[model samples]
Target: MMYVFLGKNVAQNRELAQMLTQFQLEFELLTYDDIDETILNFCMAHTNDCFDLLTDRLQDYRSRSDISYSELCQLILSDVEKHIKFPLVIKDDVVYAGLTNAEARSLLLPKKVRFMLSRQYLSKSYHVMMARKKVS
Candidate 1:
């Protein structure tokens, strides 16, 4: 039962969740709020504590080169380009993926379900933490 997740802002979320429920689909939901917090935490950890700290790091890296910030970003992404993949999650025993709006609603419909789903979702690398389940 693989599904893909869509944001709540998308009308698709309401349609999909209702359709999935009517069909009695067994799945999970992952909300954007959870994702946002994780991203915020990561940014805070990666960013410098202060402007001076950031400048120092930038100066150290550009001591010899005259690369612009955009160029530096491109260099970073070039390195990241090598490691992109689909996301998935494992629970009790089943593995789920292709997390559409419906599936995410399943996970988010209930607080307990959402917590468990988020925990498992968080355990995996965000680079590939979708709930893609293999069909039985």
Candidate 2:
């Protein structure tokens, strides 16, 4: 399973989809309507100390209107573009990619999932440290 968090910019998200297509990997685009406790935790685990901030933004955005749990996911994409490191590829095992767009695009889909997992653990990457417990 691959969950791709979408960006605010249509073009960027489209490009990301195209990039995934080029890699020949099928993925589902995660949008505001996908928010939930699990999705929130996923974004929180991926983000660096920004969960409260995101929640607050969602509250602020609610303003005078009601919002569903999934509707609240607008915060993750609109507020934390720089923090997104999606294409959370889950197959035989759980594996995470880098925080940057370039890294996620270039380093994630091409390499074997096992290789990425081992490389992350070998380097002791912070995300890997969290992914093992928090993401999976």
Candidate 3:
């Protein structure tokens, strides 16, 4: 299966990408500049609110006095890259945004296990990665 990864050129994003690579998971990486209307629409459709697709860092931007929550949401929906979050992982119909290592591990372990079993019965050594996705 192919996954879509949206993230910036930051340490955390890089680390997550590396972990996914080590798992032999195939994915397409998209930076802020690469975000487009189609991707935004997919994210909005899968998440309850567009903000649910953003990173914690964008939470601070959402709290700014100049913009209301709705306005911030609008900006995100409009694909305002700066207001968007980093390290977003989309697979099947699920979208994972701003996940920690532990969180990513929890989410990925099951999938990785499934992949390994699908390939070979051997128990392979694999690191744990965790993530969270806001699904309705």
Candidate 4:
């Protein structure tokens, strides 16, 4: 769905572009000058949401440098997780296809989903824990 071409020279980059002209892949041209604070913020917020923000934003960064996309994604995840503490286990592994709600249920069964919130009232909820499967 996404193709990244990071070349050291104009000729090489252009050749890659020409080859991909018909594939209908989403393509972006990135250089050192392309990044700004807005791009950094976008990367941070979206990375927290899906963990693919680096893949979406740093394709060329990895290509131009020695790093691979997987490494970049890991680095981004590490940096983001440092700032937040939540009760659920977070993972950055790529799921070939997106997980459906049923699949998520199956995966989390026998496991508990925990929340850190603590409040006295129903609306403000004290911590919540989702215990796995139960027999009737």
Candidate 5:
């Protein structure tokens, strides 16, 4: 269970780290400055995959798009098992937790969790490139 948390500040971000601790969730924290091109590229790929789905979800509900991460933790705390499988992106309090997989069964999972190629391929490609770089 890998949780990648993007915190805006080191001090401000501790709440998430603590919450994860309270729930015994393992996570890596990254601030805005820590986002390199590679990480951003991977995140963007995920974002792009959910763009249309997000638009559709937004259309269905009356949700405040500008929610906070603290609030998101509470939501996840309510149903950890349901939210545990996928990575989370909680920006402005609008939580998109594995929407493609959660909303549709076998929708983006097979395509995404492959070894190489297709679906959200950028993250895999990035990892491959980095591994090759390290090996050499």
Candidate 6:
């Protein structure tokens, strides 16, 4: 599965990328500047209810200036860097945005456990034997 990650080229995004890599998850990273209208529109279409939260968060930017909410929304869509929350991950029709470390870990743990179990099975390791014993 191909995952889409939208964020700036910052430490948080970098960490997210690294975590994905560590889990051997395939993904594409799109920085805020790299997003265009087409991609934004697609995201909006596929985001379902998540778009509401995104728009609500975008409203926060309006408070920073005198621009009307509509104008601010337009500006944010045009230049997402101004309003984007980092480390947004889209995979398998689900969206994960601004995840805390615990959240990320919980999301990844299943895959990690599967990978580890596969490796242990292939190696026929003592750990695997012990695990089987515990299961029995």
Top TM-score hit: 3
Best by lDDT: 3
TM-scores of all candidate predictions against the true structure: 0.25, 0.44, 0.60, 0.25, 0.32, 0.58
Q: 31 in model 6: Cα distance from truth in Å?
A: 0.9
Cα lDDT of model 4 by residue, 32-136, tens digit:
233334443444444434333333443456346677645554554555323121111112322211223344334422332212211233334322322222321
Scored against the true structure, residue 8 in model 6 reaches a CA lDDT of 53
Q: Give the poorly placed runs of model 5, Cα more than 4 Å off.
A: 1-5, 9-12, 49-136
lDDT of 2 by residue, 1-136 (tens): 5766554666666777787777678666675345455655664455444333343434455454676545555545454444333333332233343224565655556568647756877888766787888866
Question: Per-residue lDDT tens digits of candidate 6, residues 33-109?
Answer: 66666655555566664344263556555347676545644766775764555555566666666566557756744
> By summed lDDT, which 10 consecutive residues of candidate 5 come out lowest?
100-109
TM-score of 1: 0.25
Worst 10 residues of 1 by lDDT: 80-89
What is each predicted model's overall lDDT from 0 to 1?
0.43, 0.53, 0.64, 0.36, 0.42, 0.61
- Which model, 3 or 4, shows the larger TM-score? 3
Q: Give the runs in model 1 whose Cα sits over 4 Å from its true position.
A: 1-4, 36-136
Question: After superposition, which runs of candidate 2 have C-alpha atoms over 4 Å from their true positions?
Answer: 45-100, 112-136
- In candidate 4, list every pair of residues with a backbone clash: none
Candidate 3 local lDDT, 70-134, one digit each (tens): 56556675655556655676777787776676677667656756576555633232211122222
Q: lDDT, candidate 5, residue 129?
A: 97
User: After superposing candidate 3, which stretches have Cα over 4 Å from the reference?
Assistant: 55-74, 77-79, 111-136
TM-score of candidate 5 on Cα atoms, chains taken together: 0.32
Better of 1 and 5 by TM-score: 5
Model 3 residue 40 lDDT? 70
